[model samples]
Target: MLWLSCVDETAPALPAAWLIATDAQPANLPERSALRRSLACKVLARQFGLPDAAVEIGHEPAGRPLILAPQGSGLHLSLATRSGLVAIALAPRPVGVDVEQVAPASEPPLAMLHPEERRWLASLPASARPETFAQLWSAKEAYVKALGIGFARAPESFAVRLDGAGRFVVDGARNGGPASGFVRLTKNGGHESMAAAFIVLDQA
Candidate 1:
């Protein structure tokens, strides 16, 4: 099973969430996003009956979080955040999640697309750029994260292309298959007027 969640920034993490995050001293929003993501994993472990000390979150050489416990600890996790929401994804295999605020369309979507992808995006009506780019960016980020590699891999190296069937497909394979992707959109606030949030989930 794959599990994902979004939590408000003001909420404190569960007490046990601190065990593996004692060294963090977050001083900014981005830093807090990183810390909250780790704590979320601790909370998940505790929910599964693992003691505070029994479950620790550690990072691979590439900075992907991995469960550190007994050899059989059956949890795998990943996370990301946008504006005010922190998103988490858990599974029994490598997984990754990312959340991005969609309202303001922070950056130029064309800059992030692969050469081929850029052509496709250009063909769409100008009005559809933001939403489409949001999905592309989120899907690309999640794929890299799930591979346990960070930005060392260029977002453009692999493309999120489409088949004659018109379904999304990654350009290449990893871990014996293409990483699976999912995206969920939520309202920015109580209002439906602006950029909302998108949670991208990817798994091996």
Candidate 2:
């Protein structure tokens, strides 16, 4: 399951399956890195019933976080941080999570989106474009991260759209196969909100 919380809140309790958490954005680069590892360790500790110090995090050549000490844990995770929030996801299989502040963009970056996604956003009312753009971007980020490729695969190479059931769906040719995820708006405070997405790919 996915979970969301603030950085100031107590460390989140882990679930038996997948887990996602969001918190207040740390103030600097060092803090961000530390927070990401801290959260990852916490999740690993609880999920595997191990001590926090026993769970170590390293980075793959592609910058994906890896479990260094627990040799055969069979786990995967991804992290994202934006203007006012930071997010992390942990899963028994590969998983990705992204969170971004929801703010209007006077000039939405249509060129970065897949053609079908661009057209879908164009079909929405002007007032709805900003949030829709956030949703699409977050979903795209989450999907690529799950693939462990990041932007090595172009953002415009795939499409993210809301289906009739209002669930986020991804399509287009990509290295990873058979993925699933969701994008949703999260209220952070009185006037601030965020868009977050969590994606998991099928085991090979």
Cα lDDT listed for each candidate: 0.54, 0.71
lDDT of 1 by residue, 132-186 (tens): 6766676677667767786678887877754333234567646555544555454
For residue 86, model 1's alpha carbon misses the true position, in angstroms, by: 1.2
TM-score of each: 0.68, 0.81
- The TM-score, computed over Cα atoms with residue i paired to residue i, of candidate 2 is 0.81
For residue 42, give model 2's deviation from the true position in Å.
2.0
Task: Report how far off residue 180 is in candidate 2 (Å).
Answer: 2.5
Off by over 4 Å in 2: 4-28, 164-166, 173-178, 189-191
Runs of candidate 1 with Cα error greater than 4 angstroms are 1-30, 50-54, 69-71, 103-107, 162-168, 188-204
